[model samples]
Target: MKKFLKIIAIIVSLLGLHSCSNDLEMATVTKPEDGVFKLMSSADNVTLEKENADSQTAITFHWDKSWYGIDTPTNFTVQIDSIGGDFSEPVVSELIDNEKSYTHAELNYIALKFELDPDVEGQLKVRLKANLKYGVMPVYSDTKVISVTPFSTLNLKYAMPGALYIQGDAVATNWSYPIPDEQTMVQIDDHRFGLILNLVGGKNFAFITSSSGWSDPAYVAPDSTVPAEGGEFIPSGSNTTPAWGGTPMRSPADSGTYKIIIDFVEGTYSVEPEPSIMAVPDELYIIGDATPLGWSTGPSQKFTKVDDFTFAITIALTEGKYDFISALTWSDPAYKAKTGSEPLMGGNFIESGSNTVPAWGGSDITAPAPGTYTITVNFKSGTYVLSL
Candidate 1:
């Protein structure tokens, strides 16, 4: 029995040693920094012809094969950014199948997104990025600059929204986001939306695809220079453009009703004076503790129309607070009591009657020394003046 036990111990020891010898060894390999790769461009200056936008390639971008420590397929892409930019925020190109060619239409769309004016000289910084290992090591190539002149027409892959919504200080909610339902634009057709809005001049507004949140992509004025009325618009938000105003549509400086039309077909927008000022009362009046009406909101002191854009009224005002309203009702659009170019869009001013426990009202302008004063409001210039 002792001899059998000795034999069994020897066999177990031999099997354990063999298993350890067959196991694989492992170690960490530091990725090398030098001689990663280089990116090259076919042309330093490419003039994009509008005629070739559909059928021709603008330029060919290529890069050398990248070698990581391990034998793994690498993902390569080219990033585009404006010249002199930090490259901190860049638009990455889809380099599918490792192809580096870009069509004129694609390049032109990118140029427009970067705010490069068409038919004008612009510079784009291009660089190559390679992911050697997923979520781990990556390498970058030196940036190459290319001068390009994009065409006027831009064709991008941005999907159009089925319905459009607008909100801002100029429209409903008075610049508050998560806009109310009243501000949702009426769909005119497949790609057009027309809405007659009482816009307070001097306040800026923009359009959104979804009314549920502001984080969704929005549309803004095409460029930095915003027309007082309206003009062409472009896509905004981080998903669309890196840097565009959250609300770039500036209303007419004069507070009045305007018909705003947005055309997704042409990627354009227009704002014109509407015949009917449905949202805002045609005339404005004064009502408050300072006014003769005494906040009764029944028979307010009305302003005389000087022109389509101007109104004037000379009335007796005691020392107190007052505000301008378009109508006798407290719910119509009115001018805030503050001294600024901003006009209150919709007056949701809640009035608590004498029987109510809590009272609520809109802001009122303080009278600067009560007496008779002549007040003039100019919508075009977006200014109100009080002359004694």
Candidate 2:
């Protein structure tokens, strides 16, 4: 009778093990072969519109959950690369094991990284990356190609200029031609340029696309009027044979750090107080996925102060986003991605500061890719440059 009971217990244990094995199709009873999964997209080609970027989905990518040799929580990363580029150095967008979809802005941001011109269709490759726990190698799904037509971030209403500059007695320059770097206005967007400066109150200033000659277009104040705070302005075309006669902007009654945002799309400009008396802090640090020490709330990487208002650093960065902090914790006095620009990819050297913004909490600055980059920030001018 005892032997019969022992045999019955062994049979029950065997049945339980088999049930668990079936649940974990990838159970490592022996070294299991990697499981396969099919990846599919909702569209073969998509035309991206800026208006619909935030509210709509550009495309949806669904896939079967991948099976590694272990039964653990797996992470899925969607990668994108230029067509025929293989999977090397693709832009990464993370997804959970259960969720699958890509937003228009998210995909469009990746498409632009391939240098796809706005309003033009470009092709790219997509793949799924599955990561497992216990240090096992992550497996990847087969690749698929898609064509995308993306619109420019710049306003389509205005003729985009190569660059913009501010020249006048109110700024560092005295209406000089061939504008210097210091007086050059920071490109804010498709039709806006801005500058933060200690204007010489009561002096006059005007905007210029170039110092080429009298024919170079000039943006001047409307009717020689200066609003009590700030208001509308206009651009002078090159049609006038002689030099322009319209009034340039008059400096405010008070002299201090002020922000000027020139908007070509609306034919207006705005000026206001900025920085809220925040000077260049003595100690500045960068904290984010781009740095050696990632988003840990502990200490972060510091920058070498080149001068009173400038800071610079050369460091190796992964493809991630970051921002500057004055203290050890995420609090006030943080230098976020310049207002009106992508945190990760702000051109080779673009300046960010308009509307006195980048608010207290702004988007983190984006690193172009995984590489060694030099970041230089001029707090006086509220400008930053990222270069590889």
Candidate 3:
């Protein structure tokens, strides 16, 4: 009986060991072979419209399932580049795990990064890369070429130019009176203005459209606090009411720095603490043969601060090509790529460095013609436009 019991215990131990081995089993991973992974979709031309930009998928990419020795998860990424160019400057878009497609809006946004001419068809090279895990070799599928038409979403109707100013008892020079020049507001659009000023708590203020003369089209706040962005205000008794009796906006608890934005179209105003006033750079220089100075930084055109965040330069640009750079070198920090509407336009001021440094060296901003143009750079808004 002792020997029988001992044999039974041995059998139980062997069965337990078998169960543990099965639980710890791992599948054999097979490294994907190069040719096994390929794009399954046809190279069809795609056209994306700016009107349907929201909630739209630009294009869907399909690919054959990657085959490794065992079934394991794989990451897929879609890369794009200018036609016939290497992938060195490839614009990487979608990165998904075990997914097969990307949306139109996603790809459309990526296409804009190329800065393709509006309403023009441009060829782009597309390819897919699949990887199993870190420290593992990634497999690249054959490149596919596709044609795409791109458009700009910027609407000229919503953008315009005009001048604005601050007034009221809260201001030092003009207490309850209008002083246009001393407190003139910088024009953002035909109706909007960006104003930076210091105020005394509990003091009341208002905005006057005129520089020298006071009048009816003045902006008044309804409450003690300034209006927020999209806050609406309609002047009451307009040309009929006393200017001082008109509604006035009062300062907040503590007086310090403030940024005010007034929009006339929507009849709104927003007041908030100035995050931190950006000191207007001592001097902003324009370089290139396009300028009358001809690439000389010293004789470079000087910028006049219209406000704490705006600068303006009115000069004759002789044609060729030009850019705004902090200094006289081909590197950054330089302002390039004048996009938006014709006549009035804007671009980004990219920081310094190579392709690795983001937003550097965009296309040169061209002059409408070989003549003088009034150029304004609003660092706060990240926009620069030329005016006649």
- Model 2 lDDT at residue 360: 52
Per-residue alpha-carbon lDDT of candidate 3 for residues 304-330, written as tens digits (9 for 90 to 100): 767666778877877666677654454
State which candidate, 2 or 3, has the greater TM-score: 2
TM-scores for every candidate against the unseen true structure: 0.38, 0.49, 0.37
Assess candidate 3 and give its TM-score to the true structure.
Answer: 0.37
Q: What would the per-residue lDDT of candidate 2 be over residues 1-388, giving only the tens digit for each residue?
A: 9999999999999999999988777545232233356568999899998876887899988876635544567778888887856666688877666446677887788887676878899998888777765535677777788999988775533465677777788876676566676666666544667667667787888777775543356767766656735667655675643445567788888877687777677767777766543467887778888788887434337788987667788777897777777667664656775443654534212222444344354567777778866777766456566654
- Candidate 3 clash figure, as a count: 7
List lDDT for all candidates, in order. Answer: 0.66, 0.69, 0.61
Residue 283's lDDT within candidate 1 is 82
Q: Which is better, 1 or 3, measured by lDDT?
A: 1
Q: Write the per-residue lDDT of candidate 1 for residues 1-388, one digit (tens) a residue.
A: 9999999999999998877765522122335463356668789998888886778999988865634644456777688987866767677875434558888988988887676777898999888777654645666778888999987773533445766777778776875767665577755433556666678888878888777766456888866576776667877766655665434788887887676777776777887764333333378777788888788565437888886555778787788777776777663345543232223221112122332223332356666676666777644323355644
The collision pairs in model 3 are: 30-69, 57-104, 58-103, 58-104, 164-185, 168-176, 169-176
Stretches of candidate 1 exceeding 4 Å from the true structure: 1-36, 69-71, 94-98, 154-388
lDDT of 3 at 24: 54
List residue ranges in candidate 3 displaced over 4 A.
1-36, 93-99, 158-388
